[model samples]
Target: MVSAREEILNKLKKAIHPEPEMPDFDAPVYHAIDKSLGQAFKENLEAVNGSVYLCKSEEELVEKLKTVLQNVPEKEVVCSENELQELLTKNGIEHQDYQERQQAIEAGITSCEFLIAHTGSVMGSSALQGARQMLVYPPQHIVIAKKDQLVDYLHTAYDKIQEKYPDQLPSQITLITGPSRTADIEKTLVMGAHGPRELHVFLY
Candidate 1:
């Protein structure tokens, strides 16, 4: 008998269109993975007009984020707890409770690290202390991932998870790609049907 995971994977395979070629799982897979991830993100975040930015370090990323916040009209910066607090205090951006702030942010914006990209899916995980709202509530989501984290495929992500936590996994693992969409109304396409309308990725 097939396990629940296998059954779900089979359904996912049928639901999502397959790529022309399987992603290479070799050491050089990072480049291809990055390209694929970037393409997927661009396709999902249409209003952003495929804008993507790459930064080398945390300092550089912070600087770019500040610029984005300043230059983009009415744009709010939504980040994880640590980054949020630092930015609020240092930059004097007034913020409410982290949870409430995240909820408001999720209604419009968010940021994360792309843990896995496969089948056009971007995976993100959160810790107990971390705010999951940053990942879930945003209408537009931006992710920052190191080039080294780009794996060839979903199976590679699973392997890494196993290796990293042999005994147990996290309570939740989110795999997102593209905008939340549906064609339920007589096959008419609708974006942001359930979740974020856009997904932006920044790789460095």
Candidate 2:
């Protein structure tokens, strides 16, 4: 007796097509677009509702941050970087130092390892910044980066990461482009589904 499973398998066996040869992927991939790295990054990031600012100096970066941080609730920003912390304190902004128990954080302000210009991505690792949870737990994400940290391509950022951590990479490395978003429910777009909905990069 031919059971339902046997009948389905026999039908599938009767229908077959010639297999096509696999294409070669050994060659390096190439992209054709505007060559301006910073401009491209700003455009790409803004396209997804993320904000980007090019700061000429640390003072300017601090001022911009102070204004933007006002949007967060309780004017609370969490950060672990000592230098940045000092600057924020001097500016009279109230921010909680990175702590395990401080769960009601308005935003996590971190410095990223590299900013990929072509893809508008901010690459971060535990060694470059803080814990893995800091990247994921916050409702808002603010990345502070210098002009030197900008790279033209994503592979270039990976190369830099490898150079920095030659022996072993950090336990967690993340590549974030714009805000956390999805189009899963009834084809409607939503942000902050899995991570921070608001992503702001202060590039100086």
Candidate 3:
């Protein structure tokens, strides 16, 4: 049966490309990364009413966050470590653990990583721990993805995952695009009906 499936797939591939040459998967991946990152930046800027900063190190990240939060009054910073605690304390912003703050952010925005982007979906792994709640419960979400994580599409992301963990894929995989929206009430479009009203991505 496996052989038959392979044969069928091979035939389909050949039929689609008569030359039967290997596709330049890397090119598409690169282009997708560039395009998606640009789009994500624009969308995020608009959605978050904030700017995305690409930092090379933790120190730079802290500095950027401090600068951004300088003008925002009464902004509580939610994070997971003592490192961030130090930064927040120095900046005079209240800090809360990412896990402990989940309830508070249930109506706020969360941020996470994008496992795939084919359909503009955001993927989160359990290993990220309590960060998942940050991405789900808020009215707005922001994600910071490294350049290498970008793929041409969802299947490519899946392929990369399989390659990295041949036998240990996570039990749950989420593909989210845009905001959690609906139009059930008198067919009127509504945002944040079920979840966040906006989804933003910062590709760095």
Candidate 4:
């Protein structure tokens, strides 16, 4: 004879049904909104306590970076993009390479895969050689991107990412909107609770 526990389990198993097949998902439909993509992005970013700057040229970008460094005066900087080194040097902002990236890095400069205007999000990955850590560990994250990188929505950004690495994808991808914030502990509400406190995007 079967034991009481075995008899109960057998009855329960018979009552269970087969799992259903997953359903297919189609592209989403989005409603229209006012304001151009860049404008929307800037507005949303600022609403979340992030900063945005538009630069007409590399010179202007570097100039603005110089001003930022001047304001901080004592924080260490880490540059993740090699293309930006010349600009940093031209502007006389002392910064080390990504090798120096750490929690102590007050600012991190890097490129991105795309900027989603709908949510004011900046997305990047190892495919772009963007250190996943630099996106979080630094107190300030300064992203340098071109206007051409803007996309209307997040899905479009993912599509672009797929096209970029068709053969093999990077191990890590990150999407960031504003300064990191959390109120998990006692609902005190803290910014940069887990990631960078400041997020500044320079779009040209």
> Highest TM-score, which number?
2
Give the lDDT ranking, best first: 2, 4, 1, 3
Using alpha carbons, what is the TM-score of model 4? 0.79
| Cα-based lDDT for every prediction | 0.57, 0.82, 0.56, 0.82
**TM-score of model 2 relative to the true fold?**
0.81
Which residue pairs in candidate 1 have backbone atoms (N, alpha carbon, C) closer than 3 angstroms, thus clashing?
106-137, 106-138
Candidate 1 structure quality by residue, lDDT tens digits, 82-174: 654564457554444444453335323333434444354566666423436666566766565566666656778778766766788777767
Give the distance in Å from residue 175's predicted Cα in candidate 1 to where it truly belongs: 0.9
lDDT string for model 4 (34-104, tens) is 88888888987888898988788878887887777676634378886777777777777788776754436
The alpha-carbon deviation from the true structure for residue 126 of candidate 3, after best TM-score superposition, in angstroms, is 2.2
lDDT of 2 by residue, 73-124 (tens): 6445788777767867897777877764355787888888898888888888
TM-score of each: 0.58, 0.81, 0.56, 0.79
lDDT for model 2: 0.82
Q: What is the lDDT of residue 142 in candidate 4?
A: 88
